[model samples]
Target: MKRLLLVALLLFKWMTYAQTNLIKNGGFEAELSYWRGNDIATISPYDKKTGKNGCTINQYVGEQWKGIDQIIPLPKNTIALELSGWVKSDGVEKGKNEWNTGKFDIEFLSSGEKGIQNESIAAVVGTTPWTFYQKRVYVPDGASKLRIMLALGQTNGTLFFDDIKAIPITQEQLNKFQEEENTKRMAAIEPSKESKVTLFTNGDFENGNTAWRGNASTSNTVTKEGKAALMIQSSTFDWNGIDQIADVPEKATTITISGWLKSEKIQQGKDTWNNGLLNVAFAGNDNQKTGDDQNISFVTGTTDWTFYTKTFPLPSGTKKYRIMVALGFATGTLYADAINVTFN
Candidate 1:
């Protein structure tokens, strides 16, 4: 049993490692051993440097660059390269090439070129006492040589570099990095807490609002003397055939419908006992349909605001359904907040 458990643990670890992605921090380190200058040696005063703890190169103007001066060889399978370094500008801001900015620049040199193709960095020295800067470069295939230069760019003040790195990039790694960035952007737009959407107005039936239709007459769809209401015309009585509704998937296994209900009068002919009862049915006429209990509806209060809830199991062959708050067979005013459907 102990041996079996050990094998299982190793398998689990391997699975986790395989699923993990690149773009991880602190993956590679730069070696300053190749640097060649009297006044420069790679230094690390910034906290982002990978292995050497705070490795950095100290440089002074007119004394030749003193930081890490040599490029570390690329890995055997390396396809792309990204060179990043941190520099604090104390020297005068100068230098106009790819390698340097205000305080320091990094250069990449290939085997065939002698001038600065190996990649160099020069920076415009700033007066902030010390501030960090970073840069990244790409490398091509079949390239064998790499080098670093500190004084390639012209500047007047002291410059320092730390935490230098040369990283290998792959398509998969780039894609993963892009995906992480996209996720962060999306998370900022709609936080998980605000995922639920809410609408407070009662479809504009009350407050002198005119967004609802009733009995083919717009003049009295709303009332100020008593309670406001929404009425369905006899010609437009079918619930599923209504225009404001959208389709729900037939395979939806579970559903919940909840809203507020208050009515002074219900369909005029039905028993007053069942007048306030609301129904959510697939068919307009329950008698014509299966008349089964698959539909959900309830009646709660007569004069004041009352909450009502209904949940039902869907039939295997059911196609589409609509939400309805109908008075049995009577006529009356119903104020409602149509909040329906929550996904698990």
Candidate 2:
């Protein structure tokens, strides 16, 4: 009996030691402690997928790049390491330009010198649900440090990261984890039917702002496909806009808003920051703003009517949404027509 008790205690100790997180504050529960970055990222208590907190990186308008990183010393003679985390994003752009997307990366370093840097293979664009990502890398000989980084490079959007971990693993275990992750990803990508419902009234402005409000009027000066469109003509230097409240169906995961827009001699003023900018945004049921405002297009000069669209994830428990269109800090005329909102 004594021998069996000793074996059990030994097993418990081994398990506890193995489960220790190698990265300090890996779950971000301590609010950026042991992490290095600018104010571009913050600890969000309510935006986490797991634990009590998560890190959020924001790439606001006119910003170039932003990132948060941590460096830790490598264990002696470590052969391989596995890194994993959960991430979600909104409006993250993707292109050949590395600067135009959101990325999570791991790099091995020799003291302060850079070695291998591996970025997440999955393309993070538009709105996404919480997803798991994992990567295993072989530690090169003489490597002294490992760096974990999350960045929003040139993309105008937001990224949330949580439940991060890094640990040493054997090659066999890494291979098995990779295969399992790939299989799960493939299953998730299988196409499934999604029900789409329109939730806006008088979206086409055919009824002449019957269900709309704000500094807006109906006119024939600019129309996309109908005889009338919502028009906002700025005679003086004050912002003008329009909005309508609509219900969102329960269990809806995605929302898409679109419209046709045109501008004539839109001018930017020194006092106005977002001058000549036309944009759309989705607000919560309480008439409170939610998420980032999506800019359809900005007009500094005369331009013909153009169609613009944006897709965002509908927040959970959101029973109602307020759609808004506004003209900021400029003079001239802005026309919008054929507005559409869809929930899926």
Using lDDT as the measure, the top candidate is 2
**Poorest 10 consecutive residues of model 1 by lDDT?**
235-244
lDDT tens per residue, model 2, 1-344: 64356435433432343354578887888889888884668999989988799989986686466888888988765556657788899877664585577777877788876775554533477789889876545566667888887888667788999878877644444334323422332232222224543357898899997877555788875688779988877744334566665667777889888888888877654323335554554445444445555555565557788888877787655555656665553568878788888778
Instruction: Give the alpha carbon lDDT tens digit for every residue of 1-344 in model 1.
Output: 64356435433432332232122222224333445553343444353334544433434455333333454454554434454555555544445544344434434445664444444333544544334343334444446555545552433455554544455644454344423422332232322123342222343244433322121221244332245544332211111101122233534665565655555543333123224444443321121222243334444334555566667765445333444444432344444444345322
Residue 12 in candidate 2, Cα distance off native in Å? 17
Global lDDT of each candidate = 0.40, 0.67
The positional error of residue 31 in candidate 1, measured at the CA in angstroms, is: 11
TM values, all candidates: 0.35, 0.44
User: Model 2, residue 101: what's the lDDT?
Assistant: 74
Q: lDDT of candidate 2?
A: 0.67
Q: Model 1 misses residue 53 by how many Å?
A: 9.5
